[model samples]
Target: MSAQPESVTTPARSWFDSEDAPGRRDLETCIHCGLCLTACPTYRELKIEPDSPRGRLYLMRGLNEGRIAPSDPLVEHLDNCLGCRACETVCPAGVPYGRLLEETRGQLDRRRATRETPMRALGRWTLRHVVPRRERMHVIADLLRLGQWSPIAALMRSDWARRLLPPFAIQGFAMTPPLEPRDARSLERVAPRLPAGARMEATEAALVFLPAGTAKTRVWFFTSCVMEVMFPRVNHEAVRLLVLAGCRVEVPRAQTCCGALHAHAGLRREARVLARTNVAAFADAGYDFVVHDSAGCGATLRECGHLLDDGPDAERAARFAAITRDLSQVLAAVGLPDAPASLRSPRDPSRPLRVAYHDPCHLAHGQGVRAEPRALLRRLPGADVVDLANADWCCGSAGVYNLTHPVMADAQLEKKLDTVERAAPDVVVASNPGCLLHMRRGAAARGLDVRMAHIAEVLGEAYPAPEMARAPAR
Candidate 1:
């Protein structure tokens, strides 16, 4: 009988048996130093132990060791976290709070089969089916644009109509900017507007742009999902700035979404799938660095290697992550080109542009890119850049957190809006798409007149086509 296979006995499986469970070692790394408490937006607002980083680490430890159950209160505490990774920025012991929270949420998602509320179900379905695909995003953006431009928008904006919908849905619609007409949104249609001096070359079906002078470096642009659909203008401007800086910029249409939203929502499986797809898309494309304008997307792209560290695609993912760069970081490295003379004195020749810059949490904390954006902002001709207090604090967008947790998101948004109001900036610049959307909504809701724009948009304005500058003189 072969000794009955040695009568082997295996250990019983727990609810947290999945690979998504928090690493016990990473959890132990937290020294409960509390340095991250003040840096935490939720801790600063709620002033609670459970909401703080150290407190969350303790909860994670208890759950990992099976000392605690996945109770309603514990799950709520974890869900309340923005996953902005701001805690990672200040943790002296280098606790991997973001990874711990994400993995813990993944395990919680697997364990709680009965917890799927209608809203939550809808969110998951959309994330699984819609987000990673570029075409679906365009279709959704079109539908939204149609509603906004039609009488449907006014009807939905009414208080009674808004009450009938989910709060996040209402807030999301209110936050969106009017979309570009379909035909005008294509990159082909937009690129022709570049200055006469600009030169564009093609490589392996990717668009490469070089300044009038010799190219200093080559860069590949990671065109984001929402960026292409909703904010095509910003993408165009970013391209212009890169070409102006003597970069041989390449735009590979094969690139898709960075899967930041998937990771943030604890859909690690889906995130990994998208990460692999991105690896395949950019694998053969040759470039020194991959550039992204949105801070949230850039941060996630930089972590792709870590996301797929142990998988078959590990080496490729690591290489891709190594080359990813935020737009400001790359621009600052190559040197910020001088603004066109026309932009120098557009408002008042005597006074520089009174600009207030809001730091995106992902850029400031997640990627340590605080100095790069600020440096680029200051380089604009005649820009009197003023610092906003608590500028690095979360603007409450937190990648759809405003939709999921309106109350907490509002508190932070209101605080940020107040600071902008006091500064009285002619233009409030945000480097992340979510921050721009949230801040714009906050400013609009409060009847504030401050114009909000992406940092690239502001820089693009400074380097207008030569024809535009000569138009007035002619």
Candidate 2:
């Protein structure tokens, strides 16, 4: 008889085994093609092979094969990644880098022996308690608004403010006045259904618009925590525009924050709680679809269904996820409003304002929505929409990244600023709030006349308001 094949013993589990436990099909698909390396911001900055997507995959492989320990420097390289998901868009092998990194990070957090600390505790508390509660967040936002006009505002304006204050605080001043909260009756009265024979609403499922503070669209507005406390006009604009497109609008007061920040920061348990709360809040509304204007929130809600583990709630969670859509995607489906004849100009006419569009990572890379916003910008009168190099790159405001990894965050922001300066755009248009804040600070740091506005705000200016419907678009 031929000699029996040698028996092979399975290796003991390492810290990285948890990542493999979920199956590495996405990770194993990577062929080290180097395409993602070119797209990675961290790799571009460090020029270190180990920091690139391929490098990270190699390290993960080594750890799995028992060639490297979890405590190796390789772990630091993985931890340094912003989880921006930019690499995901460019990957030819279709690797799920974001999911892999998230799993890896989860493993890291669990394996670490460190006990609870004040900062970590504080972060958990704020994310769990403050962010999900609209009333509490509104109170804090009002306080910040008050501080903006107070003597403390002067302190906030100091050069050291950006360094000393939390990243959220640095960005909080951009919140505009809250929108007037409307009950369902008022929303129905203000934004009635369109006349018969208008563009047929998609019969697949009723599109539930969660207006994240823009009044442009007439669709059902969620009036989320931040939008209600801060950028109210955005939801108003969104509602107005939706109504213009012949959508049935509902302003549901029961809706709250989407819990994206909490989920991204490893507070998955808290995120699930918020998800359940939101699902219950909107459960009996009988809407066919759910939509969000904020890409960050929309993405979170879209994926929240997956976070529910083995329970009766999982089916309901999946149902909620099924209906979620980004506002841009919804608008793109509805088609753009007809640009008024007077608004059409042969050249930039209103002023010599050069506007640059920064594609928020959540909207562009995370959700693959790069064109609709740009198309909307192109229709604006006298708006010079210049495309900066690496326009789709993340601003390093990966949710709370600026707060937790300020140095790397600043480095990424500086690179972004350099690109913006080269393009010399007077105004920066970004889709997500995190990017807007980060870009605002970068511009302020350089004393550049580059103001930032949401895409909806910019579009709202191009369209005439309800009372001014007969007026020509500016």
Candidate 3:
């Protein structure tokens, strides 16, 4: 890791030249109140000034003022940040730390001239090329599924064999849920099982579900790429729950990845490209809201307004941003039916289902959706909900933070799991795919006898199909 070239000719304008780069105002807005320190995960874990929000702002300011170049040390400090946006929730100064950090990263990316490290190059290739395209992701998922059934599955789980694999690959394998076949991933395949005679129409453009009764509202469900591939059951449950809540649901097939990962990784141009594609995907949806089950995807979808402000389709981006809502928010807003009798605890009908809610950082800090999910959960028949200590803390699942910064991620994860164990809830609910996957792997690795589900899945349990309702408990 070398310092940025000091002797190189300065650019004609400011060193931060990219459109994605933050202006002086954003940097100046950080009043250095130190209010964000307690809320910052990295600062708490490392107890270092450089890892704190204020310190990072100082580095950004120094670079902006030409007092320091983008040294490897500076870059390392920036990269360590989780981008969880927890600081924003408590910042009295309203400093856009997440945006500033991203913009600064984008600036460095634009200025860099050295070749990328092989691992970085590979990561970029997958993020840019594979993850965004559904067909490519499916092909990769199919391959992974094949590996899971083959001898490679043993190799992946073997401690000795894991030592032979790249760290990222091992981390990736650990995070991935067992893959299901393509047919099993389709929402159409489960249409027959949707509650209450709901009618569903599927096409390459979108999947539309008409409620059994008159629709109170209509929304387009923003299915995330990773969620679609790795956690289709969550998506399916989300649709069924939405339809049951008196809303017609449409899932636009043309919609692509929300580009949260790209933007977080400083691929600004690529993120903007995906934003434009999504704007067009739901161009004619004409729905009340654009709903997403994954907190990360919803937060990123809402960012289109800022990410594509300079593009020609800025209005479309604005439209997309305006309607984007997390699944909990939408459900809370639209209201849900009274919990059915069957929704009570299976072990003892006299007691409520013991559920602990893990607030995904993006939903809690990004979308300000702390209460919606809990409110929905409490409404479940005989639901005994418990508060997770530091529920709003990042579960070390800030997008790919667990994979890239595993050590810090594990440290935060240890704290979170400790809290989970203390609560001893039957099920832990998370709204983001990353958090669900990361926490699920952690819980399983420790051999904790607890079930992990997306908020949608937990809520969906209350609205099982008629046939399922009659079936005796196993």
> Largest lDDT belongs to which candidate?
3
List model 3 lDDT by residue over 1-474, tens digit each: 877675565543455664677878989998888988989999999999999999999998887766777778888899899999999999998888788887888778756722367776777899889989999999999998988885887788799867888787888887788888999888786588777668999877778999887999989988899898999878888888888888999888888999999888888888888999999988874688999988888888998998888879889889889999999888999998886654555566766778999989888888888888899998887679999999999889888888878999998998999999999887889988899888988998888877788887777677776654666222
The number of clashing residue pairs in each candidate reads 0, 28, 1
- TM-score, candidate number 2: 0.78
What are the RMSD figures for all models against the true structure? Answer: 4.6, 6.3, 4.4
Where does candidate 1 have its weakest 10-residue lDDT segment? 4-13
Q: In candidate 3, where is summed lDDT lowest over 10 consecutive residues?
A: 465-474
- Residue-level lDDT of model 1, residues 286-368, one tens digit each, is 67888999888888888899889888999999999998889988899998656764344345567667788898988988888
TM-score of each: 0.92, 0.78, 0.93
Error of 1 at 16 (Å): 2.4
Total backbone clashes of candidate 1, pairs 3 or more residues apart or in separate chains: 0
Off by over 4 Å in 2: 1-8, 14-22, 59-69, 72-75, 110-118, 157-224, 282-288, 340-354, 381-383, 466-474
Model 2 Cα shift for residue 444 (angstroms):
1.8
lDDT per residue for candidate 2 within 1-474, as digits (tens), equals 776554444564544644223245665788888999889988988899988988988776665555667664766687678878889998988887765665565555555522455666787788878988876876776666577675777787677997887655555453232224334213232233232232222323232433233334344455556555555556656665665555555555666677777666655556677888777766643655565777777767777676664556787778877777666666776666674422322134555456788888877777778888787777666666788899988888777678667788889898888998899776677877677767776777788766677776666656655543454212
Computed on alpha carbons, the lDDT of every model, listed in order, comes to 0.81, 0.66, 0.85
